[model samples]
Target: MTDGLEGARERRVRTGEGVELCVAELGDPAHPTVVLLHGYPDSKEVWAPVARRLRDRFHVVLYDVRGCGRSSAPKPLRGGFTLEKLTDDFLTVLDAVSPDAPVHLVGHDWGSVQGWEFVTVRRTEGRIASFTSMSGPSLDHFGHWIKKRLARPTPRRIAQLLGQGAKSWYVYALHTPVLPELAWKGPLGKSWPRILRKLEKVPAGAYPTPSLPTDAAHGAWLYRDNIRSRLRRPRDDCYAHAPVQLITPTEDAFLSEQLYDELELWAPQLTRHTLPAKHWVPRTRPDQLAVWISEFATASEPDAAGVPAQLAAPRTGRYAERFGGQLVLVTGAASGIGRATAFAFAEAGARIVVVDRDAEGAARTAEMARLVGAPDAWPETVDVGDGQAMEKLAARTAAEHGVVDVLVNNAGTGVTGDFMDTSVEDWQRTLDVNLWGVIHGCRTFGRQMAERGQGGHIVNTASAIAFQPTRALPAYATSKAAVLMLSECLRAELAGQGIGVSAICPGVVNTNITATTRFVGTDEEEEKRHQDRTTRLYGLRNYPPEKVADAVLRAVIRNEAVVPVTPEAHGARLLSRLSPRVVRALARVRPRV
Candidate 1:
């Protein structure tokens, strides 16, 4: 056993930047890979034991994130040190080392903050299999949390000022012009530990400033610049969709744990743990942290690669087993897509509230939802187009179920008549149900969901038509388009509040929607004939609504903002984005059915 450390190994690998990271590898390379990122004022040595303990079963890789111990610190440029640049640095290292595969990731301190940043931004998470964050908060949430905690009158304000002042010394030094030259050339060479310890104790009111040169300002400036740039731009521009695990220390003696209050805002399925330790968890609690990392690494399944059955289906707790116990309210829950969606959520074990304007049809759907295996289900005949009715139903549901964690705003009406044939009422009605109904549900229930302070998911049903409007159904398509924009706006607004919004765009689902469309028909026979012709011309195939329902649940857990339900929907979204002119031309050319 080589005296209790036979499995340990280390090597040095140069990055694309030509900086050599003292890479430490533990466990078997054949095992699933897990990468560990260490924060500033520390080096890869911090994760030594962690790598050792996990080496037997995981291909654990530990390295300094950048500009830390045993790694080179390049001079900062205008675009350097940005989060995007930092994320690219991580990716560069990962590609150079784990080129053929994705790996489970763990980061602590500054590294964790970067990890938190990477997971919440879309471009970065696709490459990560899973993430574990230690002492990191969603940056946006942390800023808000800190401001709120420090905003009170008197004592709290005094405390905040004191804390901010203490931190400001380092912050200001970086902004100074000659700080970098001084720190690099001054007599305080290699005094990193002293500097780190002083900052650590000062924030907790335990230490006095030690004599240090203003030259140390260079490093401080890098941090200040990064923080400023980050604040100016929100994470939504870069948010990634990756499952996360967060671990906090009880006695960090620096940043407050309050920064992590609303972590679900970034990753809905976030799992958290708090350990009794200090800022140096990689050094102080390596063994314990290693155990946690190993479990998470093995627990997450790789979607693109072959993940073992044991790891993919890792058992959940008794509590997790009852996920279906939650109540799922879906609007437009009568026929067609809505009916299929009701059945889908029900199959997942959620209690269904089948809501539609058609009382009798909604009741039948409620029964069908139960038959589909929902734990318990019911029906509500409420016109979604009616704002007051929506508020009342949302309030009553919250009162009855205690909470509605998942809300699918699926109710909608369409018209196939030409734009010239559409009246003001027709346009307004389309807008009322297709656009305003979604807004009402979001605002009325969204406020309550936010107030509850629990994680919630809202899926608003848009249409493929939203991506490209046809002249024949201008009112309907325009309303759906407006709904799409609204969903995007809400997703951004609610991200920091732990409320998720997903815009679901489904292509034609085999539903009886055409029969219900408000058209200029003189008689029942005419209406039926028109509906039949519309369906036939559209080449409508009845897609099981259950597929969309499942996708909604998955999107919620993944915290995804967009849900395209079919290949046609995906193609429409792509065309709208890549070649709008072509999309418009195609839409304009389609003859009225």
Candidate 2:
């Protein structure tokens, strides 16, 4: 009880099964109750980080299951750790905490497994208002999944079965007779904290290891009692009785994402989330998890905070599940691709920070982002070309709105000219915004994301000219080429830190960038004419900025290093990779403009 939850009032509730469950309570009891549950090899201490964040708004509760932490293990632990018994323990805790009001249930790992049991079984129905699950699936659903796969056994299904089987080697290890107990009580126990830090990215000294060995040793019965039986004869009536939120860790080693392919069949009221983290999100990404859990729990209480009708509905955007509640910053969001990208993320329910050199335009974009479904949006006026301003913007963003989960380095100016015709001023201006802007963004905000220790994404907008060089636009091509290299280098550098860097090549989508484009060595009238002609040609192509925006989101979700958005952009990329001589020949041709 005293492990990590400071100021938490702890008590022991004795179950009918004669097991004493250790329960911790925080916040005002009259507020909406939110129960936090941990998993195998972990006690209620695992929920400490997330619980701290939720205590202000909700009555937070944490409890060690019968056999773990400070709780008394059941007598004859073999059969005592069954899901049926676990359900009884949960009910006992629920009755002791809040008898009249239903509580919001949250779980991780084995806790999620137990939560699935709690939310699905009829005995506990009407007691749980909502259930948020991560890193665990229902035994019934898993059983169904296995049955379906074995029934068909296609090549793909066979491979999936084998893959999941390998990932679950630890489960098989625990099922071995006395080996698990020996390992947990011995060297494995002492080394677990180190293993978690090295593999799961859980920071050192943050994870509580004092009671881990004992807790883990006792917790093995959880797998022993429930896994084989339930997985073999999973209940047919195991359908969720409450709204469910499922957060899937993309890089989880123990579970496969495909396991939840048919989860909607079991959880009718479901919201899905995909995190780029590994297994232990509770420790590594508590901030993001807390936000999501609060949002999901709050959504259940429609009249509690005067919730709007639109906010109450399920998100319908493409990556809504992944991006919802995340903080995103987009530079050059006043117009063109940046504006479209801001709107796209807004529709996915991300909190937007719309930034641009133009104050009024940035404000307008922020307002539009909120209108489109962003939980909140703010405008900042800053020239990306100025390194000092970008640094201030980065610091202010972190201080005011939290570290941006996604940063779009999208501000750039277009320059068109032959190498000889381009002046020193033109080259400097082109490099300042196109190359140095991206440099400042990555150096400043990327550091913040790294310092936060949670993962984030950085999107740098390049141009097709980066790939397919042209004689007509030497200065623009050089700046974009530099951007492409920077993105590649940063991607490699940040791969270790869970930060992704993507270079997006948008080709020539119809945007007002033409208005700001500079034509070197051209007379004023001729420059205007070229700009008009280029804008008209781009309009005729009718490739929308929205498509490029979609590509940006997709690239981040997939962690793609380089993305070419339009058809021409894709073509240029392919040519650059497959036929450099052809690209060079094409580059030799002069543009009519």
Candidate 3:
């Protein structure tokens, strides 16, 4: 009786082995079926959050594997949890749920291990439509991986083998007789919730259901019955028949990413996703999991989904696996860097929220983004400098589209002239659009991301002028410098919450910002001339905004802190750190403008 699966419609199915499995179903039966399986020590409740999110579109089903949750444990409980018995139980459930249609299968940890068996075995062929696996690998695949490494053990292969062996310490522990059961049923079980909270960042109240002790106690046989036999005699013909989606958590302590490097050979139709969380992604990243599952499952079937093959295979662009099906919001997306960033994310299959003060331009960007590859695109009109407007936008975005996974605060107003020459109006406007816009964005959307508890990224567009301060551009430098400092401070603050903040210095890119730049202490005609001249100079520099956009996406993927996009920006950054006095001396030199 966990809080996670409260609303599910429950039933029981007796397997051929005389084991009764408890099943829960949600959503319309007419929709595409998505069946979720739980891992060791976990039951159907582990899929509750993900199930809830998918119910609207998918006929979502979850079931307690035999010997876990409310399901009756095997009479002997020794060899009952073997892969053979598990497959029998799965086929029984599938026949009962959707006898006519194949199901989209999703699994985590031990469940994923079982899924690898189900997808590869010839007996279960044509029963599964697709597989989404996380945190676990096929024992056969793992065995072959080890054998390959050991057959010709190089230094790198030996290191990898040893590293994975170290991570599998629990596997060895689980194979011990009686000790595992005793620990799981006693003090370890009692303290399991707290341990998960402290170590895995798993939220309390919903997981580690009341049957955890018994479940964990009985689940030890999963390793004892299978790990040794399968590894010693791995099957040669274990190729998958259905499309497979592998979701790897980069921070998973229990599993190494190296385990899946050869996954493509086994799964001919393979799509990969990289998550930034730890082991318990079901609890920590349910929303993202649900989105990816829905997208891939739909894309896996052209006829059942009515989506064209070309459109369905959306995760084909650079870094597509990381950004596909994610929600990305880009401010000032009407033109230049912001628009380019939105398009880059779009090409990688992310849903784009195009925002700018220019409503028509934002709409245009969103439209073009959809044509590129974005599953969905939205145009938003907002003045980011207005804190209230930003707050409202955040609330509305949450209400309508869900929380943003990535945020790009790329809006700015350029100001120029000496410190004394740049009037208060110029400073205020520049600060409003540049500094205050980023502040408001970070406050509003960043709060949503933090509250969601799932990881996210924020990219703030600063400039080379931020680090290499110039007398000719005092107000602009001050605002951008403030932005850089704020991004650094915010990154430090959000580091604990898995939210990354990046400040990008793009330098003098060939963008329209130069055309709109205001030259303080100049007549209207003089300002126009200066703007044209600066725009021409930047055109001669010829740095494309698309490259800056690529850097923004790369920074998010790498979780970088400070990124300098242009050559000039990188050199200025180098000078600022290595020799500040030299940079200061250069800052004093008057420009041609």
lDDT scores of the candidates, listed in order:
0.67, 0.89, 0.89
Ranking by TM-score: 3, 2, 1
- Model 3: ten consecutive residues of lowest lDDT: 305-314
Tens digits of per-residue lDDT for model 1 on 1-593?
Answer: 12123454656666565655555566777777888876643455556556666677878777654455444554654344556666767777677557777778888866777777776666665567788888655555555545655556577655765664564464455556665547644645456545444432212111111212222332344465576556444445434466677777766665555556666765666666665446666654554476557666767756445542233332232222223445678888888777877776776555678899999989999998778666567899998888999889988986554457678898998776777778888888888899888998888888876665444789999988888867767888888888889999999999876788998888887666776787753366877788887666545565766677677777877878888988899999999999989988987774645
Give the per-residue lDDT digits (tens) of candidate 3, residues 393-478. 99998766678999999998887888888888888899999999999999999998887767799999999888897889888898
Could you tell me the lDDT of residue 238 within candidate 3? 95
Tens-digit per-residue lDDT, 79-169, candidate 2: 9898889899889998999997788999999999999999999889778889999999898899989999999899999998899999999
State the displacement of the C-alpha of residue 39, model 2, in Å, after optimal TM-score superposition: 0.5
Q: In terms of TM-score, which candidate is strongest? A: 3
Q: Which model is ahead, 1 or 3, in terms of TM-score?
A: 3
Clashing pairs in 3: none
Please give the distance, in angstroms, between residue 55's alpha carbon in candidate 1 and its true position after superposition. Answer: 52
Query: Model 1 off-target regions past 4 Å?
Result: 1-322, 521-526, 536-540
Q: What lDDT does candidate 1 reach at residue 500?
A: 88
Superposition TM-score, candidate 1 onto the true structure: 0.47
lDDT of 1: 0.67
